[model samples]
Target: AQSVSQHNHHVILSEAASLELGCNYSYGGTVNLFWYVQYPGQHLQLLLKYFSGDPLVKGIKGFEAEFIKSKFSFNLRKPSVQWSDTAEYFCARPRGGNTGKLIFGQGTTLQVKP
Candidate 1:
């Protein structure tokens, strides 16, 4: 079965610390990758995506990720994170075949202490 998994259920970090969240998928064919973040009281927004181009992709708010094809992983990283970066991060993939729905992993909650 095709699915996505986020290794961290919750994270706590001080401001200006480095951040890395693990993500892995179990699909063997072509797939679309996405990272969505929902801040406190805000709607989910696209952090980044990997779709047919370069495997290294950058997104809003100083976030980036690299897609490792052989490992089936797309891990999110940031050099220094701010308190505002605190939010729920969800890794999603578009369902393959005719259905265009999205499959989201159980989100990772990031808490940054100021």
Candidate 2:
């Protein structure tokens, strides 16, 4: 039995601010980590993911995440934020094997003010 947890409930920021969303998971074997974003009126889209490469993986919209096996954590980070970046983010990990089935965390809403 494995699950994902997102510690942040809601986050607010101004334009061009730094952003980081905490994400943790409970699993004992190799797992695929993912960060997904849902815009105001759009479908869920992937931000970044890490499987078996370098610990750090980059995604679209200037987003990146680091996979730390020792920590069982994969935190999302962005150097700067923009108004367009305002969205709900979810940290997810696959259930069982790498079959593309994801167990998502409690979503975190990010609001970027001007």
Candidate 3:
């Protein structure tokens, strides 16, 4: 079955520190990858996505991820994080055919201190 996994359930960091969250997927065929972030009380927004072409993709708010096919990993990273960056992050993959649904991984909550 196709599924996404986020390694970190929670993360804490001081303001201006670096950030990296691990993500992995188990799918053999073609797939679409996405990282969605939900701030304190806001709706989820797309952080990044990987469909085809470049393995390394950049998204909103200075975030980026590198897709590794062999490792089946797409890890999110930021050079420096802010207190405002604190939020819940989720990794997702679109279900193949028919449904047009998205399967989300267990979320990772990041707490950034000021």
Candidate 4:
């Protein structure tokens, strides 16, 4: 079965610290990768996505991710995080084939201190 896996359930960091979240997907065929973030009391928003072409993509809020096809991984990264960056991050992959459905991994809660 195709699914997304996120090992890190929670992370804590101080302001001006770097952040990296691990994400892996299990799917043989082509798939679209996405990172969604939900700030406190806010709706989920897309951080970044990788469909084709470039393996590395930049997203909103200075977030970036690299897609490794061989490893089936798309890890999210941020050079420096702020307290406002505290949120729950979700890694998702579409089921593909007309369904237009996305399977998300266990969300990771990030707490940034001032």
Highest lDDT against the true fold, candidate: 4
What is the alpha-carbon lDDT of model 3 when measured against the actual structure? Answer: 0.93
lDDT of 3 by residue, 1-114 (tens): 788999899999999899999999996656789999999989999999999999999999999999999999999999999999999999998866757589899999999999
Q: Point out where model 1 deviates above 4 Å.
A: none
For model 1, residues 1-114, the per-residue Cα lDDT tens digits are: 679999899999999999999899986556789999999999999999998789999999899999999999999999999999999999989777757678899999999999
lDDT of each: 0.92, 0.92, 0.93, 0.94
Q: Alpha-carbon error at 32 in model 4, in Å?
A: 0.5
Worst 10 residues of 1 by lDDT: 94-103
Expressed as tens digits, the lDDT of each residue in 1-114 for candidate 4 is: 789999899999999999999999996666899999999999999999999989999999999999998998999999999999999999999876767699999999999999
TM-scores of the models, in the given order? 0.95, 0.95, 0.95, 0.96
Q: Give the deviation of candidate 1 from the true structure as CA RMSD.
A: 1.0
The Cα error of candidate 3 at residue 24, in Å, is: 0.5
- Candidate 1 to truth, TM: 0.95
Clashes of 3: 0
Worst 10 residues of 4 by lDDT: 93-102
Pairs of colliding residues, candidate 2: none
lDDT of 2 by residue, 6-66 (tens): 9998999999999999999996666888999999999999998898879999999999998
